[model samples]
Target: MSESLVQAIASNQPELNVEMLEDIEIEKLGEGNAATTKEKENEKSKKRKTGAPAERIALCKYIILDELPFKAAEKEGFKIFVAEICPMFQISSGYTSGGCKREFSVSPRLTDIVGKSIGELLVDVVTQWLLPRLFSCTLDNAAANDVAMRHVHSKLNARNILATNGQYLHQRCVSHIINLVVEGLEDIGMSVIRGREAVKWINASPSRSRSFKDIAKIAKVDTSKFLCMDVPTRWNLTYLMLEAALPYEPAMRLFQTMNPYFASDLKERNHRKMSIGVPTELDWIEVKRMCGFLEQFYNLTHLVFGSHYFTSHQVLMELCDMIGLITDLEEDEDDGFRNMVMRLRLKLGKYWLEETKLNPKMNKILYIAIMLDPDPRQKMKHVEYCLKLVYGSTWANELLE
Candidate 1:
């Protein structure tokens, strides 16, 4: 019947085509209903395809500050603080860019672990609370930490979830190791100690501090930034003290005349009068030189220990640059600087040797981290060569496993 109606329309007969046009309108309405039904089916199919909701698994790095001394908590015992930090993008949609989000798992309000073995306790906390999310752990280079890492590895292995077969379980704290290297330089130590003692005497009395500021003003030195005392354990504070005091040498000399406290304090502190109590002309010169020498370390420490982004790839390169700087300084003419440079070189070289030893599965982790970076990815021939040297020609193949 449809073929006959189409034939009549092709023949150009309007009277016969009128009924055919009405029938065509009825068929179009039915087709529209079928199309709507098909659309509903597609929506249902999509919902079925994504039945179980997708989850974003977050990766994090944990830092453990062992045995933090808090006065309030000290009534019971020392406290250990654990901080879990992760790149913001993984867990936070709003903070998708720039810096990591940090949460303290163990706050200072809690007392330190006692009676039970700390290593075992930490392992339990990590395995139970953080094992699902933690990527790696950073720790200070204390002898106790060596045992703790071993314990962590053993527990992780038992669960068959040890990352990289537990090879990269521990991250060496760069800041602490840098502090150790700075302490090893005896000449810098002497200059810093003298500067520290001078600042301490001035800070001990409000009158002396006020007088020192006035003297600095009279000497045309900028009084906007006041002198800061060095914390005994923090080498960075010593650097800051020397840096701030270097410009105030002339003012410090003039203030020594006005304040008898400076002399008496020095005398009392140095009972035998064995060392330079205050920063003399020579001491200031040494301080200036030490600051210059420490510039590379200061810069690299800030760079590698940044919280905003990953820095594991930069560790090897920065250490290499520092070693090169020390090697160049070794030939310097000054006897004191040469000795200091030698000690720094030796100290840094010890770490460099350990990192590049090409043995022990753990040491290769650093190289692997460098290779994983998109910017320096596979461009580090040194890392590749070391891996090849240690793991044979099939190192790339082995890395896959």
Candidate 2:
């Protein structure tokens, strides 16, 4: 009946076609819902695809800022966490993290890194950034840095941007200066050499390390405190090595007694130098003395390198303590120890003593820092006393003047 009605309508109204009638019937029956569902699906797909890039960028930032290892992203636990929170994000590999590090690294061109070039770059940065005031620049003991600092001092002085005509513009790195002082006593005596060789012999192989651990246990020594080898160039590490080895001295002696091969092996390695064979009673005594001497330097180095504390004000007090330490140790009866202390004293004086021609004149800032300190113990009188103890009263008065 509907078909017949449609035919009658088409015949009565020639403009209206059967196809147009079919479309109107389909819309009424809700067959267009399929197209609407497809559109929603497409919108959801677009959102999912776009979310991944943002999540990846966040992951990259997390890795970079937290200083996490590249493999951290690919770990099973991390991947599972990422999947739970962001299913669309794919975890990257270590290689990808390394690539990101390289891309983000900022460094000056290495082709021309001379003092003049360095000064120019620094001036450019200071000008572009428009810093209100330029103060000191701490640098290690390097000839090139000396030249660069002079150039910077001149530039800032010409602009009238520096106080005191840039006299305190070059601050020597205290840690580096300490290193130089300690390094001056590198070859203290054969006792240190034998002690180092003993440690090296113990840590040469896994078998030897385990044997030492077992011996330490038998000697009732704390096995948790393991022996460590020191880098020759790093005095702090050497101090640590000696400190760690002191507790194991009993174990070391017991092992030496049990295994004569220990001394024999070291002797062979040292080409039969009897002095470098094995640590003796005298060697242990000297080592203990050396450890005590180096402790101050180790502590000062840590204090100087602390990032969360203001160390400038404390440097003068610490330097006074160091000078006193060296002075006290200078009276040791042992010729070798006295010689070592003398060498360190000479080196310290070279850099710190006001009367010495080799002294860098930039240490006035240190005195200034101590004078400004709010500590009751660090008043002007105390500074004067410290200077008098280090330099003579005449030089101290001159410095104050």
Candidate 3:
């Protein structure tokens, strides 16, 4: 705060005792005075430790460096590029009657990712664009990223820029890890295959879609919603397909009986083979159950995808909630769901262990974020309790200490 603002505040508080006013004045004057040798040394140490300018120190605390990758299909051959990645930041302006207030902003930086290697490209970006501005980098769990981060640390060490000892420099992307866990679950079982085939067939051609609509009308079922095609890479699309198709189970079954061509088309297009097998009543029930199960994950993903606000601090709590749900579902009466949850639980456990290996500085920053959150006062005691529950007293105590 400026000295003028401090004086104004002190002047407005007439009831302020002489001692309080004197202290405030003294502090303001101290800020205006020249720095002592010891104070200069301490400031330099802090600057080196954080790799941030004194002016930018507060703003860099929660900034994130990420890469948004895209394929350059326009070219003759396949080429991938890290098209753009925006840095997101939040800064508190001043204290209000209610509390402190902050403004959020995003600045996107675009750079060609083609170079000698991915690590070299990343190192160049870090040095030229991020070095002093970035507090940490959030990245997908890929072996390439591990190599890239190691390269970054090596460069930083060579420059004597030991920001958090280059340990807090790497912040694992929770969303990517969760997507992988869900992918693993999908790989193990073809539980959604029947539902996928049913949707794919009905939505394959206009004639088939019209036939399905007519069947829905004849069966006195709702025809407002249509079946949706799902992309293999995004599981959310599959969840959405299942959700949209569940209500049309009766119509679909009747349509399958009425039209034998539902199993195969006379001609195939786009290398898509004819999809066989309509979803049975039992299969529809399973789809509904899987949708219910996946909704939690979908919601959590939406919550953390936010960039304008704090997210890292909530990662642990969300993981805790997910693990708890997985634990409960692992003992489910439905054998299928129980088995799926078992696979998901294993994946979640593996990622959780990897996340726990984050540097102490990164953990400290996340804890500070949680404590500073306006709506929820995540006190240290509560954080410790959660840690203890998840990682046991020994580990939690060590973290707290």
On TM-score, the leading prediction is 2
- Candidate 3 stretches greater than 4 Å from native: 1-123, 126-133, 157-162, 186-191, 217-225, 232-234, 256-276, 334-336, 354-368, 388-399
**Candidates sorted by TM-score, best first:** 2, 3, 1
Candidate 3 structure quality by residue, lDDT tens digits, 1-401:
46576567768887875667678778977866645756876776665546535424533332322211122223323212212211122123333554211111111111112212666876677777755644567777755566567776777667766576765677767777778888766542344777776777777667778988888999888656678888765887877777788888888779877987764442232223534355667767777878877777887788789989778777767766777778778888978678888888777766564235544223355555566656555767667777776667877787777
Question: How high is each candidate's TM-score?
Answer: 0.56, 0.68, 0.58
lDDT of 3 at 103: 19
Task: Report the C-alpha lDDT of model 1 over 1-401, residue by residue, as the tens digit.
Answer: 36676776758865656566777768998899999999987776565445322212211111113222223232322122111221121222322433321221232222122212556876778766755634467777654566667766777677766676776677768777787778765445566677888888787667778888888989899646788887765667777777777888889888878777686667566523565566678778878978777777887789877999988777766666676677678898888788878877667655444333333323455666777878754456766554454335575345434
**How far does residue 159 in candidate 3 sit from its true spot (Å)?**
4.4
Identify the superior model by lDDT, candidate 2 or candidate 3: 2
lDDT of each: 0.64, 0.80, 0.64
Candidate 1 or 3, higher TM-score? Answer: 3
- Top candidate (lDDT): 2
Evaluated against the true structure, the overall lDDT of model 2 is 0.80
lDDT of 3: 0.64
Per-residue lDDT tens digits for candidate 2, residues 1-401, read 28998898899999989998887778866756877888987776678668777867887898887756566888899988976755665665545356643433332333225666777777778789897678788888665576678788888789987777777888999999999889877566777778888998888677889988888999999646799998766788889899999898899889998888997887776523544688888889889988988999989899999889789998888899999888887898888788888898878877787663335644688988987888888889999999899877988888887
